[model samples]
Target: MKLGILFSGQGAQKAGMGADLYAALPAYRETIDQASAILGYDLQAVANDEAKITQTAYAQPAILAMSNAIINALGDVLPTPVAGLGLSLGEYSALTASGVMDFNQAVAIIKDRGIYMQTVGEANPGKMVAVMGDDQALIESVLAALQAAGKRVYPANYNTFAQLVIGGVAADVDAAVEALTDAGIQRMVELPVSGAFHTPLLKDAALQLTTRLAGETFKATQYPVYSNTTGSVFTADTLFETLTKQIISPTYFAQALQKMLDDGVDTLIEVGPSDTLIKFAKKIAPKDVKRYAITDVDSFNAVRDLLLAEGKEA
Candidate 1:
């Protein structure tokens, strides 16, 4: 079966994410240990510490490590994915998985990326709000009007057709929230993040990440991987710029998923913690396209058995 892998992004991480898998699976354990070595500390320890896991610096690498561990745990039976994509921070994990970058370099870069984003966010003091509505046109028009009226709000993430996020300076975001509320939309939730990520407020963070990324070597990808910034597969020429722009741009995740579905990915798996991306897939993908989110041993086995069964059937 053709497969599409979706890696988890930040914000869904919790304390004790992959402890069970680490204890039970040797390959998983080995991968986590390698990440811990590259990171110069216990990656699992950082994950179990609530305060540390919540911090952006620790969370990004920990999540990437967890995603990689799941991939390792899948072992040789795992089918090569035809394509893959990830939300926000998870893009680095996808790149690593697809062989565009080494795992060691990816982990190290993500650590610094978290630090840079958190530092810049603290200094700038902005906010993000998830706007819940099906009317993409209305949401864009409202945000555009606000922008024209000197409010700094921008559409940060296009998660689904029904839901998107907006972020900017705190006051401006609050104003946009009010405006949307007045325009008969009331369901807006402020995200618990330190920075207005995926907006121009994080431009400094993006610049820092660009400089950090320059040191690493990026190889040709094994298979197509969708770009969150472009809502299409990443090309060799556009990889670097797309990665940098992803920091201060709206992530077209819905568009990316549509592209994957259109490209004939019959099976979709969300790797790493949380079922967030899978839920999004459920909304966007056809019912016949098998979708599973593998966060732990049980979920992993379920998907493994399904794939093996499918292979036997074939």
Candidate 2:
């Protein structure tokens, strides 16, 4: 089976995300241990602490550590993946798994990236709203109208055909929602996020990340790693630059999924605490295939056993 691996991004993290993974797999425990050492904090402590788990500085590394642990535990049960992609911070997890960035270095860089974004978020204090029940053109029209009106809003995530998320100053986001509602849109909802992620509002954060990214090395990927920024494969030479751009650019998630499907990726395994990526991919492609989310010990074991049995049969 052609496989694609996915790592969860922010907004899906929660306390106790990795407890079952740690308890069921020794390798996963050690992976978290090593990652915690590199991060200078106990990942379990961070994962079990509700408040701390939500903070970007801790959340990014914790999710990375858990996702990597899950990947490590997959071992031979996971055949070489056709492609790997992650949403936002999950990109680092994908890169680490792809061998483009050394695991320890990835942990450090992701932690820093989170801290910088968090700093920028606190200073700017923006809001993100999910606008549904419309096409991208309509979403763009609304944002364009806002921009023309001198509102600070921008498109953040193109999650699906009908779902587009926009972000900016809190007041601007609210105003846009009000305008869209007045325009007869039925499904506009605000997201409870801390920052205007994936928008130019994060340009300052992206610049800080650029300086930090300069000091790191991104090696060639072991597999095709679709980029969220361009919704296409990213080369090693362009990885750092594109990752920097992803901070202030819209995350083309739907396009990236389409890229994987066009590349013949039929099976997708979401490795993280939430099934967000798996659900999103299936919603976009809506094709019948082997798709699953391994979020805990039971889910992990089920996937491992199922795939290992299939391998033997093949």
Candidate 3:
């Protein structure tokens, strides 16, 4: 019953998230309070503010704080995972979970990261679109053709074999949508994000984040924490580079999931505000692998009891 955990990223945030847990659990309240102190404002207020919560600057830290609060509420009753991975901004949560970075420091760094990314996005507007299909070759071919034609579009996220996200200049992204539709790939959804994240357009943001991270200290992880940029585990040597490049590099999330599967993680739990990662896991993981999404009180209680029961049975 080896467990692997997935932390929620930026896009998973929603207004009024964590309110139930904050009200019902002492540990959860304590964690959020701690985050609020570090952040210099009330975290709950930001979470309830729809307009502010959607903005990257607040969203990143808020999501991280929420995810960590969920974990704190569960405490040691939850099994210690063999490994963990996060999508984009959630990677900092993974670092915190694994003991590689202090929670306070991680929240602080993410706040700056969010602000830098937002600044870049506003200065150089770009777009991201979720593409759905199974043909990797065809997808790459279209992207290559677009690049050859001088469009800035690039694959931003390899979410699964069935879904890939493309991002770049707004005009180029719109053109890619047309090209993809013409190529008989019609399923696409425009993401509600402020920047062309994981594309070259975020180079400036990455550079700014790099300078910010230079001052932080990282410790050895208690368990392996996978990298979204490299599709593998992070080491002391590659930590800084992988985290910085992740800002502008396409996330190899499917590959990271596969690596965790190969490493014998049969029970996967997603801890965050949304169940999106679990949805992606369903498409990739084998039918036998158990998956759970723990977002709110009901889901958390259900997963906790089930896991404890299963542990007793084992």
Candidate 4:
């Protein structure tokens, strides 16, 4: 039975995330404790408390901690061998799972990344908005119109036929949404993000991350790991560079899902706080594929039962 794991990015985080895992699994608590020491912050509070969990500085580390904790828990209960992929910041979780980065290093990097992104967001003053029921051509037309008007905006995520995200200066995003609405292109909703991520506006953050990435060491993965930058398998030599570019590059989650389907991934398990990735994958993937989101004890048990049934059938 071939299984693929997907990790959710930023925006999927919520208060009380991973508290169950921390309470039910000693390993999860230990992992969070070690991450807290490395980050010099209270990871448990960030995960359990609403105020702290919403801050970009705290949320990034909290999400990474929870995703890694889930992977650790799965290691004890599920098969060790499986393919992995992550969206945006979730890519760090995928790297750690693939053995390219250790848990401590991954946590530290994401903490720094969150700080850098927050800094850039403040300096540039940008925002992200989600556009539903639109095609790429319509999005491109809106972007072109914004550019013509001396406003910088671009597509950040191609989530699905029903969902896409645009990022740029707040005023420009608002203008583009108005134009799209007038044209009856799509429904645009403002996202609760700090800045224009995965766009040229984040070049400063990307440059800083490049330097940090050069100093780190990455190991080859025992299992295949898909990359968000290219929606392709990552090799050891290109892993760090690809990860660096991903900071300023739009995530190809839709393409990655298609690639997993082509690779015969019969089952997809999303390991994180939300079911967003699994839900998106189900909408985009072939109809025969099975999907599951293991966010809590009940969901994990259900996935375990399904895997057992598949094994028995095989």
Query: What's the lDDT for all of these models?
Result: 0.91, 0.87, 0.91, 0.83
RMSD of each: 1.0, 1.0, 1.0, 1.7
Q: Which residue pairs does candidate 3 place in steric collision?
A: none
- lDDT (10s digit) by residue, model 4, range 164-196: 888988888888888888878746788888789
Question: Which pairs clash (backbone N, Cα, C closer than 3 Å) in model 2?
Answer: none
lDDT of 4 at 189: 83
Candidate 1 lDDT score relative to the true structure: 0.91
The true-structure Cα RMSD of candidate 3 reads: 1.0
Question: Which 10 consecutive positions of candidate 4 have the poorest summed lDDT?
Answer: 73-82
Which regions of candidate 1 fall more than 4 Å away from where they truly are? none
What is the TM-score of candidate 2?
0.98
Tell me which residue pairs clash in candidate 1.
none
lDDT of 3 by residue, 76-191 (tens): 77788989989998889998989999889998998899999999998989999999999967877998999999999999999998899999999999999999999999799999
Query: Total backbone clashes of model 4?
Result: 0
- Winner on lDDT between 2 and 3 is 3
Error (Å) of candidate 2 at residue 9 is 0.5
lDDT of 1 at 55: 89
